[model samples]
Target: MEPHTGEICAHSMFESEEEELAGQAQAWKYTFAFVESLAVKSVVLLGIPDIIARHGPKATLSLSQIAAELPSEKPDVNCLFRILRFLVAKNFFRAETSGGANEVRYGLTPASKWFVKGGAAAPSVSMIAMLLMQNDVTMMAPWHHFNECVLDGGVAFEKAHGLHLWDYAAAHPDQNCLFNQAMACNANIVMKAILSKYEGFQGLNSLVDVGGGIGATLAEIVKAHPSINGISYDLPHVVAMAPHYPGVKHIGGDMFREVPSADAVFMKWIMHDWEDEDCVKILKQCRKAIPETGKVIIVDTVLNPREKTALDPSMGLVFDLAMIAHTVGGKERSEEEWKNLLKEAGFPRFNIIAIPALQSVIEAFPY
Candidate 1:
């Protein structure tokens, strides 16, 4: 709570001459990339974004003011400022152009606004859970064994933790909380975009959210479209703790074996967690859960090589490698890869609906 004491802020250092040398700047930047993630996580954990937002859009919090909002009254203000400086450079927060630590006031950026709990686009578990998960000691430990894993065809995660991801999460309640919370937060944000922009859910009468975790997304869907009855489907243990929402039923079962029958089956961020063969098996199971007119709607990012924006394909690429590093056969896929997988799964045809928010929807129909 006391700012984690002192450590060298390597990212703050700069070199004028050698950085200009070919790949030197880029390489050094890459080396210190972990600092950016850590710094963001630190700020989020310390409620920096929330404090700034509480001060209102027009107001700003000075370094001392921000520090006061944190856990300790006697925290080292200078160290906090150093972290703030890194965040400012990363564009997560904005500081005044000409002011000392005492005078410089920090304010939330457009991006940081989402970190505020009750803000317009606030997601309860998004940043904190995601940041912590990526920088997790357990998850990072596997990277050290990646070379050995490559040579031996062993799993980095299994090598590090002595078990696979799902098994590890099941055995560890704390890690499971992180994964579920992060997933729920992501669903909250992405579903809002889907409901606001997309029209595919307009006519569906019944829907089942396959691999829905605690049913956050389906809860949102049921609320948005009250006419549609929703089933929050996931593993037995997950549904046992799922929150009860009106018009939404939580059913416990294995998706690979059976998904509850519905007019539409929803799978968000699921296929990316498995290889093509496994993905096809899950899709085929979903197909069984629907009738002749039914469809399996995929709510996940479509890796695009054509356009680059807030949802960078590069970020998706890192996620792909991360899947390789952490899970058995999980990885992100391109549109072509998705289509081929769908064909293998016995789905006749599919349509991709693009939304401006976080992920695109791939609707695969049973013909």
Candidate 2:
């Protein structure tokens, strides 16, 4: 007998159910994305990449040798082997069989090269390391009382430590140094990408790096472009401790109060550290500091929701969370949000030049 229509429909419905389950599995891929970061952190803290890098090109170290080099209380060598196995799977390292069937030697991959000691491109290691370390008891402890922070509508860092980030930095000299190092390391990666890709800095006679910590970005720019004179502006404490650099002058003052006058003002990764109102106030000060013909070059992430599907959007999303956890009401901005902030701050026209790095160069001009 021929099959009835209702039975056929029911059979099709069951097939659709299986397909929906498959689709849900694919959609939940990001739910497991934290594994990659944890693996990277494990390799970093274990100092495996640095050891392989010290061994030179194509050099491989056996698991036992690696464990011997580590301090006492090391995890079992087999467990280390498992970690290396996962790293190999992630392409952070390469593993090969030795003469014996049981022996396996590990080598560094291109991705692992940056984690090598004294490597120029080691910003990711510095950044991840800082995040893992600083977010320990001192920082993460506040999150338990995050409800208080939210209810009080005040800065979380203050709630956690009884002062804002800047104030806390001023009081703790060692923590301040660590913060500067982290910022410098992050700036190194960003500025290197900017100097290589962007053309806007070519003709500028003078530039000011507003909120520039230790002048890392400006120093690179001046070294690359001989004709450009630069200024590194920050708070008094930061400026007093600023490292010396040829051709870049250090200026100490509050950006909200006043900025040193210059042909162009550069603010890298600074605006997102403050709220919209605070950003507007700082931008207004920046507008007054530069000439009408001069530009205010802002280096920050332009959060694009559409681009969240891409590989690097994880970095953007992570940074957005960092802002929330560390600061009060700070956030990464969208293009429209940026435009409104600029316009509200009294800037008439602006141009966005996308750097190959995570941040973009936003040049705003006064009317």
Candidate 3:
């Protein structure tokens, strides 16, 4: 071969090897990713943040002190010490030199601060813990037979539980209450950002929170702007036990059947819980419910593949799989997909407002 050709060939071979190594690294990383999730859950379950919070701001407590505060019989303190080691590595907590033998002194990191009890701007520790638990064996048993669900083209949760998620919730009041509380806890974090940043509710005389669980989001909106009259629309069963929130009315109904008429309809994390056709049907109902001059507010994640950010595509993909496992036909959509869905649903214009939270607000107006 010519000298120049030999150099090109060598460079090409080096590049291929580099790519292979990178691919192997990523594969290995993902294969063991479940360990990190479990570690997070262990800390949350042990109430490490709450324990640290009780110690007061910037106060560090020795492992023995922490053990004394926790229930004496349960939560083996030694085992908890091992978990705290991982948490320290993850930056959820920090270890400081206390005495000669390096006693584990626990202090919160910015990330762990949100898990602290009664802390303002704290992310829902209970909710995160619940989701992590769902990822455990009891809840994940359904997913093991996901192939059967795919073959039957049915919801995996139904296959495992002998009933749909909604049905199971209806039958088991305690589980239903837990589900709602988990959802509400998640909503609190997202709604705080929405109410603060997004001005979509401005100038709207009336609003409807379609599929709003227990009226949490709407309550926050109503509380923020007292003039905005709101309604919570959900299944009769789901809304039956919904607690009353001042300035908001609960309308127990189906979205596929009808949406209560309003100047603006708000759907937070609702559309992603259904398939495209179902979403279109719900959007059509929403379009019909709202006046021509009004709008439909959608709070969901608009997966942006092109946008370079720390948020990975895997997060959206995992949620998509989660929807497939639990809901009948739920999904997370991209910005382009949202545009197409809106256009097909007969809405002419829309606006995308990115919130600080996990979801984004998409406001669509009828022509």
Candidate 4:
């Protein structure tokens, strides 16, 4: 049957019925990506990962078994089944049939293991970070106005909350605490990676952690090298809430104004939160804090689009989008951008120390 020019022809429009279905399926995945994150959030809040961990790494639990562990007096078995089914399909968990009845048992995968909180081995995963980003209404509200920020060229967070992120955090004590906790979770991960892979801290007499929240990173560094005096510098209100750490002193100050003098200045994940001018200002303060023999240590992501391996750039790209949506003029930068930023701050030379993690260590010298 010949069709008119304006009439629809399914076969001609697509290569095959199967191919068209595949395209539709791919589109659905894109459309429902947020749902996947919400599902993971739900599982984390429900303590599913922790429950599975108690059963040991290799053990699997049937739907009924998992439901029994829930705090709910009368948990819905079918609803739990559907959530687990979806998570299993996405590889957050693995499904295996057991016994004569062909019952499906769910087991944790490596991805889901990150959802487990306060595990015995090493540092805990990004559960706190995920909660801060996904569960907090204050943090999530800015995303609703993300499009407006793109169109109007303003920070989405300020647009939504009518205050800067730092100011907003200060006004809201609960949000501030969560923010510090999230940063501490990240600091533990970053410091572990740095201690193993970076040698910049070997000979320093003193080190200052600019924008250090609650002194987590500084405490770890001081514990590792007892001879090196550690100073944790942050905003006044933030430092007021920090607990005292042995061999680490917390100082409240603005990095743009002045930094505590040290043999070396260390900043982790700070530069990505400001524009070039502001970064230059902070970097200059770091430079002023150290002598000609001293250097500035910046632990941050150096975006490289070409490199592909176990350390993927996808996370960096995602973080860049997050900065765009949340911060005033913050973003993840390339190696070239880092070099330029350092140079603009009067650093004559710098060295990049690559680590096994997503961030790299950049050591910038004043002379």
Considering every candidate listed, which one attains the maximal TM-score?
A: 4
Per-model TM against the reference: 0.89, 0.83, 0.86, 0.92
Model 3 segments beyond 4 Å from truth? 1-31, 73-75, 119-133, 136-138, 148-152, 305-313
Error of 3 at 250 (Å): 1.0
lDDT of the candidates, in the order given: 0.81, 0.80, 0.80, 0.85
How high is the lDDT of residue 115 in model 3? 61
Decoy 4 TM-score against native: 0.92
Q: List the residue pairs that clash in candidate 4.
A: none
lDDT of 4 by residue, 1-367 (tens): 8656887866677888899999889989888878878888888889888787788877799888899899998998888888998999899999999899999988889888777774522344455464555457888788889778767778888888999899998999988988888888888878888888787789888999999989999999999999999999999989989998999999999999999999999999899999899999999888888998999999888888343437777789888877876688999999899889999999979888887778888889988
* Cα lDDT for residue 155, candidate 2: 71
Instruction: For candidate 2, write residues 18-76 as lDDT tens digits.
Output: 78687668768667765766777777777777777666757889888888888656668
lDDT of 4 at 134: 48
In candidate 1, position 29 carries an lDDT of 88
Off by over 4 Å in 2: 1-39, 71-79, 119-136, 142-152, 305-311
Q: lDDT per residue, candidate 3, 1-367, as tens digits?
A: 5456434443455458778688779989888877776787766766777777776758788888888788666658778888888888888788887788867698877777766555422554335535554655545767767888767677788778888778877888877777787678778888887887898777878999999889988998998888999999888888998998999999998899899999889998899988899999999999999988989999888786444435565677777777876787888999899999999998889888877766778989887
- In candidate 4 the C-alpha lDDT for residue 58 amounts to 72
**What's model 4's lDDT at 266?**
91
